[model samples]
Target: MKIYLAPMEGLLDHLLRDMLTRTPGVDICVTEFVRVSGSLLPNRTFQRIAPELLHGSRTPSGVPVRVQLLGSDPACLAENAAKLAELAPMAIDLNFGCPAKTVNRHRGGAVLLDEPELLHEIVSSVRRAVPAAVPVTAKMRLGYNDRTRMLDCAHALTSAGAAELVVHARTKADGYKPPAYWHEIGRIREAVTVPVIANGEIWAVDDYVQCQLESGCDDVMLGRGIVADPGLAARIKGLPAPDWDAIKPLLAAFWDDVLIYILPKYQAGRLKQWLNYLKRIHPEAGIAFEHIKTVKDADVIGAWLAEGCPVPAAEPGWTKA
Candidate 1:
């Protein structure tokens, strides 16, 4: 069974990719969607968003990272895929699963599920543009506002040459709600000959097991669940869970990476975001979050972390992404 780290816009950048992949069971990661509109994006844009491109499209942990593109235009998306192909990504993934209103309002993401023909055109055009050796895959929700056309949309993507598909198991209307309809993914998987990876609302080993039993998919992609517990995939694969002591150094290393990669103003929010997720699995993380929830200066947070902030002595020498 393959375990993939789901591409989460805004939250799952290369920094977290490196951090999360440090454990076990995470086979591949899709970079946060690189929005393509109007014309072909510069190679630097892909590089800036996914510097792993410069490292043979692999994260610091050596896990392969595939570049994902998001847009509505078939021809324009194709042209950009050709450009990104020059970088030799593991696979070129199209984004039809993002449910952000701004993305949907602009005719990107899950809204396109309403038009299976358009989805077909976009996937076919890009498949033709990219080298055949490089697989073209896609991720999508069950539908836009409903699951009425879920199977039709799955067939559309597969018939258009999408090598594999990931079904998020809910409609855009679901909006990250509970009770992801994994059975819906089973229906889509049965309809399509290609591999189907199940995603959405999987927060534990039990959830993973249930998702597999319900979706009939062995490969599963984890989203916020992995963020909440960096070692989630490892634990599901039967590795022992790291206690709070093991998590503290990652926080320090993450903060270190944030300082170098992001501006000082945005750095605190980055740490806070991970801490917020970590709080779900670590009580000390909850205390740390409370200590720095209102604090803006990253230096202050660093000082608090060095002093242990309830879970002290973050060991140094974490590999930076």
Candidate 2:
């Protein structure tokens, strides 16, 4: 019955994490992956990426936010994991499922799946480095280009001391396409004794139910689906859907939080990134975004999101795509 929010690189920063965790049914929020290289990451960089760790490693509303690290080098990755463990977030999550071109080109993320022994080394090194009380979990796809070694990879990670595994159910080649191949996750769940969390192509309540039923997993991690529907996780848990009017106020409140917390420090590009997701809830919100499309100043974008977007209807099922 656990629900973890997937750590989407650009999409699930602190602003969105704060807003979503405020809604019902969210338990864990994994921060975006911190790319590790030859040495320990700068403490300032880790703090900026996951300031919630300062607030007790939890969301403002108190849901725990786990820190995630991405890298392929066993030694360096393990070193960074140790430092992150010192900071002490709820858990340390390893990212082996990112399919982004740059990460794959660097032999990090999902591309590491190509070599099962290497994946084992990476996971085991970090798992042993981190404190025993702090769980070290991993997220990964089936493979890079084929499904030939999916189950074996899952077994490798679990045997290497990964507390749990989140399977995105697609190979690196699938690249976020529809039909997330949930069956593959089911297969992985059957193969591993560690907890398996299913991810990908989950956009609605039925999708959540089907994922759990099909994968035989006790938990599900949501990404783009929750982005499209702010109240989605709540709805999937059978909570009353926020009326359009109620949600509009909440959105406005969320914008206020964004303006107060994120705008002054980050780029205007981040504002647009958030609006693109908000558009899924309030299509009209895009109009406000269009007005500021050419504006590069973060202050201006924050102003627009705060003052420009029209109030959305409060009734459920307000508009259809």
RMSD of each: 4.2, 5.1
Off by over 4 Å in 2: 253-269, 284-308, 311-321
lDDT of 1 by residue, 1-321 (tens): 899999777788998998888777799999999999897788899998889999999999899989999999999999999999999999999999999999999999999999999999999999999999999999999999999989999999999999999999889999999999999999999999999999999999999999999999999999999999988898888987777888887788787888899987688889989999999988888988776677776666777677666534352432222
Best by TM-score: 1
| Clash pairs for candidate 2 | 243-314, 244-313, 244-314, 244-315, 245-313, 245-314
Q: How far out, in Å, is residue 74 in model 1?
A: 0.8
Against the correct fold, how does model 2 do in TM-score?
0.88
Global lDDT of each candidate = 0.90, 0.81
Candidate 2 C-alpha error for residue 252, in Å: 3.8
lDDT of 2 by residue, 117-179 (tens): 988999999988889999999999989899998988998899999999999989999999888
| Per-candidate count of clashing residue pairs (backbone under 3 Å) | 1, 6
